[model samples]
Target: MSPSLEKILSEIEQLTPEEQLTVMGHLVERVKKHITQVQPKRKWSDLKSMAPYPLLGEDAQEWVSRTRKFADEHREGLQREE
Candidate 1:
């Protein structure tokens, strides 16, 4: 850690628990403000056309049907064993 941060931490340790919490709250708000100012807000629409249709090489409905059929067959096999 940097010497400045270490010095600040030593000072914080001398404060009461409530004072420490107050300091923490201020720090958190400052960081949140910094992040909002520096980062761009993202939108779901931004992902449009990023992936090709049949994203995983198959239609989504077809994949769901195939997966359900598989799970049903697996469960039937387990039932037979039971």
Candidate 2:
């Protein structure tokens, strides 16, 4: 609808299908990179605001370590049931 978008579409129309696909892939990657750069890096503290239940004193590292230990202890017995 916009003049800039119309102009871009007209330019793309002149390209071969392969060329159009290449250009589309490049544009998609550029948009993805831009989005990744714009988003703020999340911190462990940010989880408190987003979580439905309180995290209290337990942080991500502690939870992961405990889970890994439990999984290691149970993995052999759990696999036998499969």
Candidate 3:
């Protein structure tokens, strides 16, 4: 639709069928590399789906609560020290 895209398509069309196929393979590899790069970002969602999280059940909740309490109790002291 755009001039740049149309120009690229025109050039690609000028190539022989075999050349086009080779170029297509290179593009596919580049796309696969991009997908692999983005895979790590799904780790948080994956953690929820995977069984046996590092911390689990009541222990995790209690740890979170205790951490919150500690943060709250020392809030003024921590802020002043910083």
Candidate 4:
């Protein structure tokens, strides 16, 4: 987990039992708020839209560099094949 999330959890643990419950309630509310704030704004990948090029700019450069490093086994070179 992130350091900030860990810190929040630590603070909740240090609170009295009643305060811990309140903290948990607040955390749940904040998480729900975050879900609402983020869910609709998220942009999932579109393979069809991404079909023309899977890489661009720095990503493209990285892809090319990694591809060159693969040598013979380019397709599965970077992956853990079954």
| Cα lDDT computed for each candidate against the true fold | 0.95, 0.88, 0.84, 0.74
The candidate with the higher lDDT, 2 or 4, is: 2
1-82, model 1: which lDDT tens digit per residue?
9999999999999999999999999999999997777567889999999999979799999999999999999999999999
lDDT of 3 by residue, 1-82 (tens): 9999999889999999999999899999999988776443555765675666544655777898999999997997888898
Per-candidate total of colliding backbone pairs: 0, 0, 0, 0
Per-residue CA lDDT of model 4 for 1-82, tens digit only, reads: 9999899888878889999888779889989986776444545664357645544545777877887877657656557565
| Order of the predicted models by TM-score, top scorer first | 1, 3, 2, 4
Error of model 4, residue 35, in angstroms: 7.2
Model 2, span 11-72: residue lDDT tens: 99999999999999999999998777666788898776685433666787889999999998
Question: Which of candidates 3 and 4 is the stronger one according to TM-score?
Answer: 3
State TM-scores per candidate: 0.49, 0.43, 0.44, 0.33
Model 3, global lDDT = 0.84
Candidate closest to the true structure, highest TM-score: 1
Task: Name the regions of candidate 3 deviating beyond 4 angstroms.
Answer: 38-82
- The 10 consecutive residues of candidate 1 with the worst lDDT sum are 33-42
Q: Which portions of model 2 show Cα errors greater than 4 Å?
A: 37-82
